[model samples]
Structure formats: structure tokens, C-alpha cells
Target: MSVILESKSSRVCINEKGAEVCSFVLKETNLEYIWQADETYWARHAPVLFPFVGKLKGDSYTYNNESYTMNQHGFARDMVFIVEHQEKDSATFLLKSSEETLKNYPFHFELRLIYRLVDNDLTIAYQVETQSEEMYFGIGGHPAFNIPLVKGTNFNDYYLHFAPSKSRFLLPLEGAFINLAEKTLAQTNTSIQVERRIFEKDALVLETKGENAFSILSDVTNHGVVVSYDNLPYVGIWSPFPKEAPFVCIEPWAGIADTTDATGKIEDKKGMNLIHPGDVFERSYKISIK
Candidate 1:
């Protein structure tokens, strides 16, 4: 069933059949910024893309001498999950590993998404609990926020501003993890071009310095949301969106983009998290409008 829960401070919407947002829109400000995409597909709030998910070599990969076929993004973001529980400003949703998924992923696990609203920020927390010792995989969020921006505005007027601009950033090659191609401070407050292909070369990796905090802003004003990843290694600015929509995504990833160097084995994938059997791992990100 479709569920929309609201608290005095936030709102959590779960498509149950698709992905359940722990907290997307907050009761704080003008952030009712969910996309109008039909619930039948992806609903614009950070999508949880994961697990040997994401486009792989020829849309195929090898594991233990066997090849597996799966979509680029994981199935969690693509299925109707069960509403495990909820209360006020928080909610928990789950999806079980399936026989169908076992064909490609080959693991038993429970995925949970918990959202909470605190102060002026809306936090999306992702948790993965492993039920098998087989292998663990990659996970990330693809939340597209409305630019609150206008059309005709060239990406040249936009600058990625970090509260702690002195912090280091990562270098991700087209389809790879957040490793240092080079490390440097984000001192640039100028326009940069926009293109979907940029992602093709590799994600513009950041040097979070264990502090996943940053923002994508327009030269127009001080208007933008401050993104705080729970020490996430990746935070990206992407609008390469068609002119029809003034939307951009500030992605917080525990994982990184896949690369030509990818070893094909999910366990061999760079930045792949290894959760001990029965261990539950959790990560989160917060977005506060300034």
C-alpha cells in the first residue's frame, strides 16, 4: 500500500512497491520538492541505487566463474518494500533478498531505509543487514532536487560551495570509486559546464576529509541547500538534465560509480562495503536549505 506519514517536523513518503523515503520533505520550509514522476517508476527523491546494480560490462558481470545479469541500479529502488514500522518523524521500510535476485546478487539480506527530521534538516538513512556470509555490495542514493532555479540559466553561473571549502575533494573517474586522482580544496565559486556525459567519464569525486558536507549553488544568490553526508565519500552536482526541467541532484554515496577497471566480481568492486554476517551497516545524509 502507498503510505505518506507526516510529523510536526517532517514527512515520509513510501511507495511500498518501490522505494520508501524515510524523510524526503520536511515540515521545516519550502522543501516539498518531490518530482512528479509516476510512482510506477522512480519518484525524484534520492533513489537507492545499488548492489552489482548499475550498468555493468555489456550489462553483465562475472562472479565465481559465473556471469550474472542485473540492472545498473539495485532492485531496492525498483521494488515495492514492506513498511516495517513508523512513528512521528521516522519510518523503517524493508525489502528481502529474493530467489530472482539470488540469480545475480547471490546474497541474503534485509534492506531498510530510515528517515528522520531534526532541526532544519531532513535525513535519509540507509541500512543494510547481511544474512549471509557470501558477499556484500555497493549502494547509493540518486535524489534529484528541484533547482528552485530557473531555465535559460547556464550551468556556468553555478558554483559548488562547501561550508568548509578548505576541505579536500575526491577524484572519481568515469564509473569508479571515490579515490584520489588528486586531492584539493574547493575554492572555486564560478560557473562550470553541465552534461550527463560528465558522469560517463567518472563522478566528480570529492575529498570529504571524513566530513561529507557541501553544496551546489547558482551564482545568482546565497540560495542553495547545504548537503551533509554522514562522512560519505561522494557528493556530486549533476543537472545534465534536459532543458525541460530545472532540477539537479546532490548525491551522497557510501559507494561510487562503476569503472572500466571494475573487476566484475561484486566483492571486487571498489568501495564495496564488507558487512560481517548478521551485521547491519547504516549511513545517512542531510539537506538543509540556506
Candidate 2:
């Protein structure tokens, strides 16, 4: 298909069949970590899950009674990512789970993605495997970066930083009708809003504050780009920045979201991940330009 992978300073333009990283061009001179071309990050490398971020509403969800058609972080980025290996900078993409993805995710899977570029940092490795014996899955990373990217950078004089405060903010779940009035898997530290309607008002599920996982969105205030995750549990800071969309999707997830008391078999959904019967799972994340 159209799997273009270039990054030996051709400035990062990866699209291994929606393993998604469509163009991150920064020729030679830089206006900081370029990003701007507006919304489009569906790089679901492994058995799916990651911006399709979090939702369970109408993309259809119900298991056991056998009803599945996941969309919104599950169902793996539209589809197409299987080119086991590549070199010049590093690349590997794959997707497995069928009878058409188990007829909408019933289980039996394999999702692997490994894209690496050294000097300028770009290492995305997400792997998952399970032929059955019990199954459930989650893998993540939706790379997006382009702000003011080139022309007169004015996205609020560019300044996005977060590496200090993290106590609470897992705010966004349109699935079971707003977690059915919050039930308490709880915490508190208000003032959180990052919405862009997709099951309605999406993204803001930051539990355990990523344990210092790493986050720095910049442009002045110390240059930019530094997203590191070798064993991520959760991390996301999306941007349709002030709306009109222009790159900013820093995500890393192992699981979380869609918990209004879930039981949607796929081994009880919610933060899923149950690999057995041939089990295998690996995870990695890193981005450069700082």
C-alpha cells in the first residue's frame, strides 16, 4: 500500500499503513519541533487502542451477548500495518487479529509497531501477542507535532509544558453516560478541560500522573519535544489546539478509560490486556527535538 518511511534527516515522514506519523518535515534549519497540518493521528500499530483514545458509546460495544464494533481507540486505526521490517533508520509494523479482527475484536491478536530514528529521537515500539487462552488488549501512541510549525508561529506564542503537577485528571468518558455520575475510583484536583467531541468531549485520562513518565510541549520556555516512555502505563496531551486543529498528540497508554462498570467480555474490557496462550507483549516510546 502506500507505506512511506523516511527519516535519515529527510525529516520524519512515516506512514506504514496508518502506523500513523504522516509527515514531520523539518529539513535542516528548524523553527523548533515543527507541527501543523491539523488533525489526523490514527497510528494504531498493535491490536488496537490509543486515541480511539477512550469511548464505548456508539461505535458499538457489548460482548458476551456478542455485539462488537469498536471505534474510538479500539479497532486499531482504520486498518493496515504489516511490513515486518525495514532499514535506513528502522521500521517494523504489523497487525493481526481476524476473521476480520475477530469480527470486531473478539480476541486472538498480535499488534506490533517499531519505528526508530536515533539522533533525532523517534522510537515507537508497541507489541502485543496472544492467540487465545483468554484475551483483552491495549497499546498506544498517536504521534502528532506541528505547531506554528513554520509560518509566523502564533499558537499562543507557543508554550506547552507539564512536568510538575499531577494529582488528578482522568476527565472524559462519554461511554456509560458520563460514568453514570462518577462512582469513585477517585481523586481530586479540579480545573481540567481538553475536549474535541468524538463520543463527545474526549481525552483527559491521566491516572497516577504517569509516574513522572515525561511531558514537555514547547516553543520558547526551553525549546521543545521530549516525550519518553519505555514502560508507559498512561500519558496523553492531545491538541486540536484552541480548536482549528494543528498537531499536538502526545499519547502513551497501556490502559484506562471506559469504566462505567464494564463487562464487555474481551475479557471484561476496561484497561484490558490479558495475553495468554502464546503470550507476548512489548512497549516503547520516545520522540526528539529539544
Best by TM-score: 1
At residue 3, give the lDDT of candidate 2: 49
Give a tens-digit lDDT track for model 1, residues 1-290: 66665656556566676564433564556455445453443345567776743456566667678888777666777777787887665667788889877887778888887766655566778788887865667777766665553355554555556655454544544433333444455443333444444445444555454665666577675556667865576666555423434555667776655556667676677666888786778887876654
Model 1's lDDT to the true fold? 0.62
User: How much does each candidate deviate from the true structure in C-alpha RMSD?
Assistant: 4.2, 14.5
Clashing pairs for predicted structure model 2, backbone only? 34-146, 35-145, 35-146, 35-147, 36-146, 46-111, 47-111, 52-72, 52-73, 98-101
For all candidates in order, the CA lDDT equals 0.62, 0.58
Q: Distance from true position, residue 99, model 1, in Å?
A: 1.4
Report the CA-based lDDT of candidate 2 relative to the real structure.
0.58
State the lDDT of candidate 2 residue by residue for 171-252, as single tens digits. 4555332353543342323222223432134444455444344444444444456677646666656654235565556677
C-alpha lDDT of residue 155 in model 2 = 46
User: Each model's TM-score?
Assistant: 0.79, 0.34
